[model samples]
Target: MISVLFFVLLGAMLGAALGYASQVFKVESNPLVEQIEALMPGGQCGQCGEAGCRQAAEAMVRGALSPAGCPLGGANLTQQVAELLGVSVTIADADIQWVATIDESLCSGCGRCYKACPFDAIVGATKQMHTVIRDVCTGCKLCTQVCPQQCLTTVALPPDSRSWFWPKPQTAAA
Candidate 1:
């Protein structure tokens, strides 16, 4: 009975100590990282050399990366990130937006492009002409590189009503 009582006391003491430690040493996520990530395009594209936008945000907060690290986000996003991080940085030149177009005449329907696309943008059956869902394509060019017939080509996406956005309001010249 005494041994049982001692064990119960020891367990309770350890539990209390752990609970106190957890409260005292609670780790908090950096708000800067969250802000940086929120400003990003959330493309999950690795053009920034990071795994995803969240990772890039973390790197930027940790000073391991620059605000212009995201190629997909472009100048506007860089500017936003810079402002959030309280750093002055030159806006990166925007990259041309490309959309995958499959030439039905050249497509062999081997399904290579379908499998290569990370976004599931390509739709078709084996031995049938494959079509690219333009709306879903991120234009990472992963499909173009994997097409054995070179049927997949990236075309510059023209701005449509959906792509258009109002320009940011400029501040008064000092």
Candidate 2:
């Protein structure tokens, strides 16, 4: 009975010491890392090549990863992350956004593409020809999959003066 009591006391003392040590040595996390993690899609899909969103955010804060590194978040998230990190990202390299284009000649106008488009980029009547709003299309290709006539095709939007960025000059490695 005495030995059991002694061991229980010893265990409790050790547990208390460990808990106190943990509290004393606790490291505060960066708020920026938290903000970046919250901006992620929270899929934990590992598509970004990180173990999880938290690790990815830490990497972003440390400059080990690019602000636009998360593939699932796409261009909008990339822009938000870039803005939060105070970094500039070129649209061509960062996103390479595509837009859906409907071939009027081949379209059967069955309304399948219109229904499948999540962005509401297609506009037309049920039986009439549909036109894709290039500005609103995310190029997800859902419309292409649902198109009965296979008329919806995704095309890389040509970079205009606004979307284009000047190439950064290469520096000599002195």
Largest lDDT belongs to which candidate? Answer: 1
Please state the error at residue 19 of candidate 2 in Å: 39
The residue-by-residue lDDT of candidate 1 on 1-174, one tens digit each, is: 999999999999999999999999999999988888887767576778999889999999888998878766655677788888889985323445678999999888999899888778899999998998988887788788988898889898776655444555679999
Give the per-residue lDDT of model 2 (tens digit) for 38-154: 988675546578998899999998999998787656666777889999999864464566788999999877998888775688999887989998767666677888887778888
Candidate 1's C-alpha runs over 4 A off are 1-27, 38-43, 92-94, 160-174
Model 2 lDDT, residue 72, Cα: 51
Candidate 1 TM-score to native: 0.65
Clashing pairs in 1: none
On a 0 to 1 TM-score scale, where does candidate 2 land against the true structure? 0.53
Q: Rate the local accuracy (lDDT) of all candidates.
A: 0.81, 0.80
State every prediction's TM-score relative to the real structure. Answer: 0.65, 0.53
- Backbone clashes under 3 angstroms, per model: 0, 0
Best by TM-score: 1
